[model samples]
Target: MRTSLSVHDLSFTWPDGSTVVTGLDLAIGPGRHGLVGLNGSGKSTLLKLVAGQLTPTTGTVTTAGTLAYLPQDPGSDPRRTIAEVLAIADTLAALSRMEAGDVRESDYDVIGDDWDIAERTAAELGRLGLGHLELDRTVATLSGGELVLLSLAALLLRRPAVLLLDEPTNNLDGEARARLIEAVAGWRGTLLVVSHDRALLNAMDDIAELRGGEVRWYGGGFDAYEAQVAAEQEAAERAVRAAETDVKAQKRDLVESQAKLASHARQGRARAARGDLPRILVGGRKRAAQVTAGRVTGVHQERLAGAASRLDEAEAAVRDDREIRVDLPDTAVPPRREVLLLEGVRPAFGDLELDLDVRGPERIGLTGRNGAGKTSLLRTITGELAPAGGRIEMKVPWRYLPQAMDLLVPELTVAENIARIAPDASETERRSRLARFLFRGRDADQPASTLSGGERLRATLASLLLAEPAPQLLLLDEPTNNLDLPSIRHLVEALRSYEGAFIVVSHDERFLDDLELTRRIQV
Candidate 1:
């Protein structure tokens, strides 16, 4: 296969002297590849480097042909029209002047052989399920899903040899995401996508994982990559077991050797004390016994040291993160408890209404397309957003976690934020609980504004889960929106151990499945 892009010894460092990517080497041929990694693992940064949006601190990037990049959040002037966003405004203006019979020679130069730009733009939009979008429409009037489709339409108009997309489906609804997946399925050029959207990644021709500052390629799509990693982890676990066994055997032998040496020394001393040999011979025997004991102990000690080294080598293969362990509180609810009641409730944002009763530890997934009343419903329940009409009765302590995770006071430290919710908790108790959430020492003291996407969510979770009364009913809205795959996994891991019932709003099918939802509700 011909390589379409290549990176040699690439490295990047932030202006604050923090290193993100270091000495990375990778190559990609003409095929679709999904790039995945943890939240701060530099997937977007690497895409920017390849697209020439950012200069690498070291190493070289080579591209065979024209490249176009779509950022996670495509920015543009709100007043710009669709034609201008597609870079065809000038050509259309010249075409109009030519048709009006007042065209200069420069107008013809601008139009050239690309006079069919208008039809091409319409056709691209139609193919992407956006035929209703007019070329003269301003960007500010579009929805989040529409904006994403508009960006894709712009990229398709250019027809670049290589296309790079970062989180293209972030805010896309079900239909919009499906449209994008269809477009991607028909793509023939070199494409690299970085996303946490599993359904999108599973459509790739191959997969590349950026872990521990390296890219590892796997054949086929997301499912294949998952199986391969599982195998690797299994092998790593087996190696750890064998190494532990060897270390134990070595320790046993060392103990036995020491015991034998002590017993032999006592026997030699008793034999000498009976006056069975002359004084000089007795002294010589004692010296010989000491030398033998040293040699025997040294040999066993060396074997034990070698075993310990082997154990360390074996343990290095595993990728376990014990510090981020999720410890569930003992707050499980009984099956007969009436947790919530929402009767004739109409939330602020959508046209839908709900009359429902939730009981016990139910895992409810509130699913719908973008612009739905999912968030509004959660807010109304929390009394943050009042209902247009109707009533909501909650019999349990409930907390709502919005997508932004702004529950904490940004100016305060994480520990201080926890203290706000759990005023009765001792300072040492707060620190101990925060440590389990991976905030130790100075990390707990770091201001909330400085926290990353994953850390902020963890902090929010800590605040709600460790509240004074201990929330029995939790409501989460798009909790996995900006999180990376590892962060998603961590969230799932934490939720697995949670005894409290929750209602989560999400469009991610894979994530919803992993949560083991007891029921799904449509708004």
Candidate 2:
């Protein structure tokens, strides 16, 4: 019943004069709350402000008890040991020094009540599926999933009353993500998480949507919020229809009033010509009619204006984050052609060894545990790494989309990125293809550095898929790792129409299901 975290009239602006959040207010109670928004909608910025990592331009934040934060990136250094990363190495060393008879007052001060620190650390790590990970092990040796779990283990060990996690599952594989979800489900303290993972959001006690500089509350999980949005949109659309009808009615009334005024004028002219009344009386009568007609016309015009304004307001309430809608007839694959063959090949970089054959239009789902080399196998298939043994035979043109999405040149615009890949294609042709990915008009001219995470990925994918010679076989590595839900959905929808064979490595089960995979390969 009590509020644990509070944000009051918070506002933040970048150095470039871009305002990301403005006059935002939110109160989070003691529960697992999911914070969601579009990629560039300032969800992470709000968390950073709440965690005191960034000072808001105005207003204040207050927490009921001790607070801790787990950032999206986690700021992990590969060369540092787990203890060092957790920021407890110095305290542990002080305790060791005291036991070694240093007898320093500072050592005693630092190690005062934390005598059980080591035991607590081990217990927390084990609880989070990190018991096998040693405190002295460097982060460099850990896989992406392990690194994420280790970071979370550090947060759990602190036992803070309030915990803030931003995109905690950014690059985690399914196993690591499940471990986090389990940990979240057991949280007893106030927890606010900003994540794009629907599965993670589904585990929350409530969902908060931050949009247009405001936070809107919804009870329960992602499904509940979606239902609420659907209802709200339905009402908004209905208001639009009513407003449109009112405008039409007002226009018709004005037209009828004008016709009557014109007929009255004609009758007055005939009376004046026939000298049916005194000149003075006729002039006064004409002036009165003109005045009345003007008043009537102005009244109708005002009503029409009000109706048009209402229609605009109604339309504004409707959300227009349109999905990518484009036809890719050329990307479709036939059902009976040989796509690729791999014979007893060991990757030079990863620990995976494989023997496989892929046929036309086959959508292969590649999966494995972290460190099992899902990415390395894809790299090897793309000739980025040599096979230690055996051979890879590609029966058709191939293209590889890596996990990092580094295909685009940072200085190039979306249109330019596509143009670089398809040098012979005309500018018009290149733009048409990019438009299919939702990059239209000036959006296609935005530099790669300026795009949001989702936009950049879409641009990079557009570039690869629209190459000079259309690729028949596509190799994708961890494609769903960092993509937001909408971007993931866009990709899934696009791939549905793709005729080319694709081998994709993704830990998102939801994404895998949406792809309607033709075959599955476990590395």
Model number with the top TM-score: 2
> Which structure among the candidates has the greatest lDDT?
1
lDDT of 1 by residue, 1-523 (tens): 9999999999998654556689999999888999987765788888989999889999999988899999877878889998888889999999998889986999888888778999998888988788887889998767555777788889988888899999888767678789898899789999999988878888999999987789999998888988998899899899999989989999999899899989988987888889888989989988998999899889988988998998898788888653356565655778869999999999876776988788888899988876567777888999999899888999988888876677999889899999999999899989998887778897788778656566788889889888878888999987887677777887888887787788998878878899999999987
Candidate 2: regions farther than 4 A off? 1-9, 13-18, 49-67, 92-106, 109-112, 274-278, 326-332, 348-351, 410-419, 422-432, 441-447
- Residue lDDT tens for model 2, 423-459: 9999998888788888889878877865656677788
Candidate 2: Cα lDDT at 427: 94
Total clashing pairs for each candidate: 0, 4
Lowest lDDT sum, 10 consecutive residues, model 1, at 321-330
Give the runs in model 1 whose Cα sits over 4 Å from its true position. 12-18, 48-62, 75-81, 84-87, 104-114, 138-141, 322-362, 371-399, 404-427, 441-453, 463-473, 484-486, 496-501, 516-519
lDDT of each: 0.84, 0.83
